[model samples]
Target: MHRHSDAEPDWDSLRERIIGLGEHSIHKSYYPELQDRLAELERFRALLDQTSDAIFLIDAETGLLIDTNESAWLQLGYNRERLMRIPFCNLIAPASLAWFLEFFASGQNRARREQVTVAGLMTADGCEVPVEITIRFVTFGDERYAVAVARDISERIRTERELRIKESAFESSTNGILIADLEGLLIYANPALLRMFDYEGVHRIQEKSITDLFSCADTDTRLLARLYREGAFAGEGHGRRNGGSVFDVHLSGSIVRNDSGQPLCIVGICMDITERKQMEELKREAYEQLRKNIEQFAILGDHIRNPLQVIVGIAEMIDDPLTAKILNQSERINDIITELDRGWVESESVRRYLKRRERPEASFAKIFRNQNNPE
Candidate 1:
């Protein structure tokens, strides 16, 4: 195979020609070392291609891009060819650039993994992407090159932000969240958790044990131990709030694991059922009050409605025109007052009554009927 000594030799045809014309006559660029080295490069390149993490090389001088993979193209929102020419510092946040330059300019120790936090890599639409970059500094034949492995934490970041938002919300939340270890040692509790424990705030709940916090700790411990071992445990448990006041909690819990699949922590989410649980105790007191109000209303209805009924009956019995007219007017007024007191007057009926100079008795009754049953 023939290759230009100064240029990138196109070996595509050389492979084909070698198969057809035989290797003996040709001065092939493909030697044993060259072939082995080329194969090694191909395998390494394939490994880089297969990696989900975005990998790219940058020039140390101006922080200019040197080359990048397909993931870098999609991630930084630039074509590989376009990215090669741009200054790497341009993608970083202005506040961080000086710090980054200072950090980078320090003599690089080759083959060391370094983590750098940089904000805002520019996209095609002028939007910036936040990236956490891990750079591996290397010197390739006296030319400085840094291989960067970047993960698009955008989703992870968003989830984290949402989780933070959720956490912040949880901190100030009405609901309580308590975190403990496998041995039932308390690690964390939100303000709401502290509040549920009625310890004033989060600081008070700290250093307090479930054993100390609970009155029925002896009975609950065995069940709780079983729950931590079991995945996705949920049940009812008795919890003691501050001041030695005991309360019930509808407790739900799960085991927390790290990347290596080892159990690191346990988080228990709880709903305070103390108020709802005391429905049985408060039942008699509440019923007594409600019963009183109902009886009073019934008595008032009887006292008011019966008199109006008698007046109407007597008005019919009267034959004298003036006497009958006055009795009828009083009976109608009584009915209107009763409906108004019972919270039965509706807006439309009131509007019509206000619009009319004198609402006729029959028209008023019709309006009341409409108010009583609106369809």
Candidate 2:
């Protein structure tokens, strides 16, 4: 190789040329140290670029972005050159402009160290994005800078909003809702639940186990077992109120499970069905009485029909008009009694007539005479 005695140095190519001098050059020791410094700076920049959070180096005095990482470019939807030219405050939403000013004004004398602030970022499309920002003042040579690490918290904000809505619905529901752990300890009960059990406050209900609310503790255990196996249970049962009075209730519940399908808790709703149960009982009793009345009507009709048949047969042997009319009316009365036995007439009215203090046969005679006379 030929060596040049003198050559004008290419300033842009100095880094490569200095490193190439290697061990044989007079400046070898200092050049290697310089190379190490450059390598450290490059590694530091790479670390910032690889970070998931957006990183920005801002000039504290001028409020301008000195440098930014790849995440900052992607988050703000802006290129590096544009971000560096714009003031850092321009990227904040109008609502958060005063807050940013205050943060920057604190400068090195910041009251809080490494405090996280929630703020909004305005993107290229003029959309505001929620972010959590941690900021600290860093000194580099003669200048002070604010280094910011911002994490997008849009999903977290949305999740919190949904949770608030569900909590509101749970508190405001009209039906009695109860949540209990696997051990049957009551974890939560809504206002309606407290009132349903005639309790004045939630603390009173909280002190009682779920089994204590039910009329039968054994049935409650069986229901809990079914809920564990099937993930849900719905049925009617008797619930004891605050005064120890039992009332019918329709309870529906389902097991709340974790992602692994392990049961976490049980949530249930109760509806008062005492009036409905009483009405059902009344209907059953009425039907039973109707059945017994029908049977009695049949037996009484048979007893009267046999004697009436003999009277009508004897009257038929006489040729007199009055006797013939009596025989005809008696046969018609026998037919009416048969119709009652067949349920062709409303049984309630017949039962009332039979149960009356006045003679039922007198009413029957009156009806037969009116049918025969027709006048």
Candidate 3:
């Protein structure tokens, strides 16, 4: 039983050993509380290494890595052995290191979260990573260090670039573009669409219905309903600009969807067709004009033809020789009269040359006068 009791903890010796280690680490004159605090920090560091943050301690003077957390190995593409050998700045992109060095060299304590555009990485295979860094300054003993935290922001940066490309395409598109949310609240409009409605900016167009710009609002409502239900709509509609001038436009609407296939927004395009509409109206007016002209010619032909036939019959019925001669001449006259009908020939020329009523053809009158006068 006494031999078994010897196996129990020697609490006094254990306490003395811990106290002796603390004295070795600090001066013998150092307060016990200060020594105790240093011990607590070592225990806290062991716990901090297990976290997901890419944590590292950077020496204040040289920015060399003194220690790193487990997350640094995964986030920075490095294993512990490789990371431990590198300066903290060696893992950072050159441009970013310059910016960071400025802050560190200032000697003023600082903390910030920043997007570093370029970053070098350290991998188990001796490769490097580009990352966004967030850091805070901390003091250990008499020395200062920075606790740098990092994350791989490559995906976020790629998304941002894609957004800029889409924006550029929308801005430069030729079609008149208008974008509205699911509630039909206008959120954006391209330059072509603004010029279409004579709106100077998107502000003037916000919250206004697609119907508001239309000369026919009821038609626009039906069109919008079809677009929502059918996912697309295309038809001609009339629109009025700021000056109250109306024009024909073909409106096309399309529904925008998200990755989940949920309806996100409505995009509309307006294509002008004013000249085509004007041409159609002009054609309709031309057909009516042609009809009226044909009717007038039909009536004129009936009036002129009927009177000439009766005059021709009376001239044939005459009996006396002189009267018969006159009738025969009159019959000849009727032929010219028919030929002169409807201003087709000059009327004054017919009067002077053919009628012979105290007037005669100039050539005939001259020859006869010379024969009869004999002077």
Candidate 4:
């Protein structure tokens, strides 16, 4: 099928007919059509004026802005009449203008199609405003014009910068950081987290569930409920590393939610506390040993004191010089026994005091040394 050329229509006959009707139809149809066309132009102007984005219609051949929306004047801090003569490059930054000119001179291939880019737009006050611009080429009558839309994206740029900083902090942190989806499967893990779990790479851990990280029974269920309800959960847990080795871990986690308050993911940090847990167990064992030693000393002291008391009583009954000597010797022996008993009591008291005060290591050492040296 052959497509017809878009040629101008023949309006001479129509005009002649209107004149032959004694100008009556001129007021009826011609004036009304003119009014309708004018009204349509007014509507188009309103659409451009009401839009929030700055719009500029530029001459493609000369690169001069021929028309602009009201927002363009407000956004660029320029008067409506003065901006009509402003070249499009005047709105671009000095440094950016060079590249803009180079690209524009490369013909309208890129401009003919829809394109979006980010650039700095020079404001009237000489300061630059970063804007996201979209441009397209269009033809009106016999002339070509580039229609450009520019939007201020300061807030978007600021948010993206903050996101980059946060991501850097997360990546460089020493503590293990991991993020898991609502289903509890791992989505992301930092280097620290991968090392903590003894995994060579994050790919090995992804698609794994939180249950794989813990040795405690029912940890996933309990933690999930707590995190979703309270939005945070923190405490000690048995974290299983690679090769099935279970180690003590202090896990801190919180729930992440979307704007609508729906659960999105869980973010958590983990620290290995295996050495600290081992130290506590050792201290407990030492404390128990110290208590047993004190009890044994008390028992031995009781048995020895009873025997010494009997000897003292027998010696007191004698009256001769030899017997007096025996009494004196027996009294000396009793005095020595009393000192031993006192020493034992003093050591036991010191052990009890230290232990009660939570100095288990000190109490254990003191008791052990006293038993060996009897002081």
Candidate 5:
């Protein structure tokens, strides 16, 4: 063995060099730098795992899955090794596989640089998970890769379906429906509303103020005020059509609010009451005519009775042979007059019955008038 120096070699510096930590050590190693890089990779992976989105890296040429994030394997219920062994197309639901293949084969994804699509991703348990996928093509040295970021959209799909159903209901409803901004400008008018107002299309009515649809000058003002104060309003009012013709309508409206309970817009429903109003008017006229007829019948009966009385007095004053015949005929005429009086009484009874029947309707009308006039 060679003789050692009197001073011992620096043990601490030697130890640091052995572990890849010291400078100017002939025995230096890269272990510490390698550890730092490994730690950075672990942190990046942890970040990807924490996200709700599944990320996949695929070989563009072979369509094989090269790597994936934790969400990808966890969401698909597959182990990392098995998921990497499977082809990317195998992960897509059968219904979406053909389109996905065509999308890649046709170079559409590369041409677009980035493309977004909604499809189903098959799970390990034979179930399908709806996903909205955004794909981008990239290259690294000699390898072309596809970067796919898929977000589970089951809730979004369900919400969209519900919205479609509501839209259908709004379109198919019989009652006219309208949506307006807080400024009273019409934004949406359903088919029924367009037809009710004799408009051919929604464009004919959109952006028009609600006041333009009502014959009452103050209708929109009062309606907005009530909606602001009470959040709702309901009553009967007159509507103006495209041709300036007016008709009755029962209007119900309320403020539409958002999740924060802040008013976003206004919604209104309109029911045409023109026919009902016409029928009520006709009934009122018929009742008035019947009342007049009853009065005329009573007056006619009284006139006939007075004439008969005069004839009876003249017959009683005379003693000629024709007087008995006149008295007998007069008695017959009196009997006929009595029959007329009986009919007059029956007519009066009928008039009273009709009046009683009309009382409730009259009271309702009175109430409505009071509401409108407010005296």
Candidate 6:
């Protein structure tokens, strides 16, 4: 029971003031922190919306869409409110619906926690859009949901189809086609290449150096060097078969390059030219025989004329009746020689024309000139 003075402060009032200050401080600090959390949530939502992949959160038990990202509504050409009202299963195209229903109903997705599938999604225009969907089961609090991330795969499918067409063309070509690495090791040989080399299978030719197929020891190196310098090569060479037999081949090759012009591999096309080479050899032989015949005709005409001239000179000097008959015979013989000479000239003209048409290497002009000059 202490006595109170007017100057003494009120204990109850001070306690009330202290409590009010604490409450005010708490309110001031709490609001800013709350605002920061809300801002962070907004940024996260924006990030999810920015991605190209369509993301959806579905109610696992009801098979209904709980929520979806911006891409989902945009891709399906639906407003957010309308898309949210639709069941997730309704979005799948008819062709893929059965598989999806089985996948969900079998409880396999729950057991695996994650699954991947390719399915078509129905668009607003009733067109099916191919998508690669990755589904993951997750729990938030007591609610179970399926998180699906879908990526469009139309471009990938198109590219695969084009690749198949190109492969088919390569397989069906008549000329031999081969692909080799930068080191000149064979990697792929088409069917025609295998048959041309008399190989039972592609495995026989694969891993073998490209030079092994050619009789020339330096063909591979030369061709590779040329490809690096000029980007292409084309020429004729002898090809060695599996049984060690050789045949003529015309090979055309180029460096397979990337879009950036960097060399990736080598591609070659080969043609068997054995028949053409044989034809050329036959022509050369025929021309050689023709040249010999022409030479013999010219020589025979000269030999016969020399004797005929001597006989004519002796008959003219004798001045007898038999001499006059001999002269007449000589005239006949001279006419025959002139006709033979004309024939030789005609044959020589024909020979010249044929020589112009033949290859430069097949020329026999020097041989004929040497034989005639006897130098």
Give the candidate number with the greatest TM-score.
2
Please tell me which model should have the higher TM-score, number 3 or number 6.
Answer: 6
Residue range 1-375, candidate 6, lDDT tens digits: 666787689767666555554434554567788989999999999999999899999988899998899998899888999999999899999988998777677644457678899999888777888999988888899988889999989999999999999999999999999999988889999999999999999888999877888765434455566556777766777788999998888887889999998889989998888898898889889878988988898899889989998998888888687988899989998899889888888988988898887653311123223333433
**Ten contiguous residues with the weakest lDDT in model 1:** 359-368
Query: Each candidate's lDDT (Cα)?
Result: 0.67, 0.78, 0.68, 0.78, 0.84, 0.83
Q: Candidate 4, residues 281-324: lDDT per residue as tens digits? A: 88778767867776776677678768777876776776656777
lDDT of 1: 0.67
lDDT of 5: 0.84
Tens-digit lDDT string for candidate 1 (47-66): 88777777878877667788
lDDT of 3: 0.68
Better of 3 and 6 by lDDT: 6
lDDT of 5 by residue, 61-176 (tens): 99999899999999999999999999999999998888888877765444776779999999999899999998788899988888999999999989999999999999999999
What TM-score does model 3 achieve against the real structure? Answer: 0.58
Candidate 3 Cα deviation (angstroms), residue 243: 2.7
Candidate 6 at residue 118, lDDT?
95
Q: Write the per-residue lDDT of candidate 3 for residues 56-83, one digit (tens) a residue.
A: 8888777888888888876766678888
Estimate the TM-score for candidate 5: 0.73
TM-scores of all predicted structures: 0.53, 0.76, 0.58, 0.73, 0.73, 0.74
What value does the lDDT take at residue 171 in candidate 2? Answer: 81
Best by lDDT: 5
Q: Kindly report which residue pairs in candidate 3 clash with one another.
A: 121-128, 121-129
Q: Residue 16's C-alpha lDDT in candidate 1?
A: 57
- Each prediction's RMSD over C-alphas, in Å, is 15.4, 13.6, 21.3, 11.7, 5.5, 8.2
Ranking by lDDT: 5, 6, 4, 2, 3, 1
